[model samples]
Target: MEYNTERTTLKIPEYGRNVQRMVDYCLTIEDAEHRNKVAQSIIDVIGNLNPAIRDAPDYSHKLWDHLFIMSDFKLDVDSPYPIPTAESFVGLPDEVPYPQKSRKFRHYGGVVKTMVKHAIEMEDGEEKEALIYGIAYAMKRNYLKFNKDTVSDSTILTDLDEMSEGKFKTEGIDLPHSKSFNIAPAERNTTAVRKKGNNNNSKKKKRRY
Candidate 1:
């Protein structure tokens, strides 16, 4: 039995050693026409091995590219599609730059921070006050999302003050209504509904008697 340790390293192991062996055999064939036919056959086998991708657009082209890759681009075959280089497979993906400024409140996220910054820069007026109120409401909503437990208006105000670097003041700002965040009403309503249902069933039983 031939162990993988003794065998040559596979370029794309997903295709398996048999597919690799077929690609190696294609490289040995001197006739371009014969090699192309063999490469096509190997691609068909590869498609069968991975049936899911076979239905994808340009999958045949991808299979042909894989055939070249498996042979380390040594296989001299007439391909319908562009022959891919070893660098194409081994090339590093483009670097994605991360945000330089970290969010003070990750729960509120970058949008809330941006809103706070814009509000801080704005001239003191009804519009700025309105924007500040909007930001506060958004922050409160975000806090509730993070914690189902009701968040205090003071907590949101403190966060807004700290995030604005003391540029914004909450001294005159009346804490927004906390009714939306309060889950007690919902629980109370549920209890009331259950009690009403029981009373209705008792009334029906009395009517039946």
Candidate 2:
């Protein structure tokens, strides 16, 4: 038996050893026409093996890229799309940028801070005043949600002012009562539990005989 440890390593292991071997064989064919036919066949096999990519927008193009990748960019068959170089895909996916802005009041969450910022930028008017109050209410709600203990409306307003660099003047804004944001626990099925208990009792009595 030819152990995997003894054989050459596969470039893309998802296609398995047989597929890798087929790709290696295609590299040896001298006739350009025959080699292209065999390359297309290999791509077809790969596409069928991974049915998930069949519905993708550039499915065929992706398959051709994978074929060249598996062959280590040595496959010279005419490609339907632009030939991809090893360097183009060297780094793989780009890194996603993380939010660097630090929040002192993390308990109120980031959304509250974002709202406060937007409220600060708006032109001062009745509309801006409503938004300022809305942000304070949200801050208070978020504070109550995060911390089990109740937070005063003043504290929420103070936090809003601090986050917005005193831009949002919520000195007299009153937030809704803490009870408004209280998350109620899910109720148990008491009736079903009682029925289940009675059924168990009846089953026990019958089983005793």
Candidate 3:
């Protein structure tokens, strides 16, 4: 009996062993025209074996690339797409550069820092003040949500000043109270209170009856 160890290794296992054998046979064909015809047929079989392969952008190009890969790039068949080199599959991709700007407070995130930078650039006016207030309020709300602790208004003000290079201030601004941090919790409390009130009324009505 032919065991898996005795057989040739599959180049792309997704296409299965039979497809790999077909690719191997394709490389042996002397005539380029006949080899191209067999290659196309093999690609059709590959598409049937894995329908989701068509989901890729430039799917026909990708399929042709796979055909070449399965044949170990030995098949001299006419291809619709640029024939990928062995190095294309083997070589490492270029390194992606990381952002140079560092976050002052990671909890508030990079977006908040960007907002603060923009706020600093804006001319001092009513619009700037409104923006500063909104930023501060948002920071405090976010801080409370993440930390699950009461973050003092002063902390949010301090972070804003540091992030904005001491440009923003909370001296005259009326920021939302700590209770504003969790609207859902406040809503839940209100619901519980109303439910208690209804239960109490029901008990009183039962006593009267």
Candidate 4:
């Protein structure tokens, strides 16, 4: 008697190294609840690390490809499609005007501005006034330049002190005045000192003769 034989083959989907690692890690978790929580946490971490990934253009394409391979040509699920929204037909709205391009910079600036405003309103004194003046001074001088070498904070502070003097002036705020603020006289004296030293050297040569 002859027996009929039949054989079947299985095809496995190939995943990228990173995706394979993630899949292996997920499979290692025994409990379904814990596995889901871990997976969500991982997704959240990735989103935080690369915010651009959240609104990526090619994400749907990549997802559909992965789904197709995973289904092994058996599942009849439709390919992923872009969700229709009121804004989808229209282009993205213009970004709000802000000094710095970085979100972190804007966040920190907002916090500083709020705290300084509160301090100015609640307190009444030279120190408070100076603090407010300083804040305004900083805001006026604050700028972001790409591709430039990093400058020392001290040098930036000095530049701010010079440039923001009249620009940040506010009504009813009196900054402490210093008596020794003569730039021209100081420069003239420095020049005179050098001249006198040179004359002294000339007199020594005459005496040697």
lDDT by residue (1-209, candidate 4, tens digit) is: 11112211212222222222333455566766655543443333223333343466764443433333323323333234432333332432222122222333331243233324344343355434544554443333232111112334444344334433433335543322222212243343454566578669987875221
The sequence of per-residue lDDT tens digits that candidate 2 reaches over residues 156-186 is 7767777888877676787778777643321
Candidate 4 similarity to native, TM-score: 0.20
Q: By lDDT, highest first, what's the ranking?
A: 2, 1, 3, 4
Write the residue-wise lDDT of candidate 1 on 7-80 in tens digits: 58777766544456557767887877666766665665565555566567877787777778778787777788
Each model's total of backbone clashes = 0, 0, 0, 0
Model 4 whole-model lDDT (C-alpha atoms): 0.37
**Over 4 Å off in model 3, which ranges?**
91-209
Candidate 3, residue 111: lDDT = 41
Clashing pairs in 4: none
Off by over 4 Å in 4: 1-19, 56-209
What's the lDDT for all of these models? 0.64, 0.64, 0.64, 0.37
Candidate 2 or 1, higher TM-score: 2
Q: Model 3 residue 66 lDDT? A: 78
For residue 63, give model 2's deviation from the true position in Å: 0.6
Model 2 ranges with Cα > 4 A deviation: 91-209
Segments of candidate 1 deviating more than 4 angstroms = 1-3, 91-209
* Model 2 per-residue lDDT at 84: 85
TM-score top scorer: 2
Give per-model TM-scores. Answer: 0.41, 0.42, 0.41, 0.20
